[model samples]
Target: MRSPRRGNAFEQAEAAFKAATKKNEPMPKAPVTPPAGKEMVSLRLDRDVLAHFQDDGPGWQARINAALRAAAGLDPA
Candidate 1:
């Protein structure tokens, strides 16, 4: 007949089994917020539409934002 577990032996075996079965979880990352209150996004603009904005030079992005805001009837950014 097989010998039976006695006293702390069963407890020790249980602890070992629990330690081996425990999951190692990674720390969750904090959400990233934009410094200027604007969220960065990917916009797919048509080539001709993009070219029209780019023709104005360096401030094209700001111009596009202004045009969008005006079109939406929102105050200029």
Candidate 2:
């Protein structure tokens, strides 16, 4: 087995990496597709929309979700 590498291990590794990357292969990377039904994020609202929801009280977010679904014809009911 080879002993520890001398100076510029990164250079050797980079050369090996470049050689490995030259193969005839699809990119071994995570695919870019729309996310499944999980892993969502929420954002704080702008002042005006926050105020509207705030005045509308507890169910306001649900109402907004329903409204959006209705607009998109996704059957909010």
Query: How many clashes in each structure?
Result: 0, 0
lDDT of 1 by residue, 1-77 (tens): 97876658888899999999999897899997766867788999999999999997998988988888899989745
TM-score of candidate 1 versus the correct structure, residues matched by position? 0.51
Q: What is the C-alpha lDDT of each candidate?
A: 0.87, 0.75
lDDT per residue, candidate 2, 3-23, as tens digits?
987559899898889998886
Name the candidate that leads on TM-score.
Answer: 1
lDDT of 2 at 69: 76
Task: Please tell me which predicted candidate would have the highest lDDT against the true structure.
Answer: 1
Provide TM-scores for the models: 0.51, 0.37
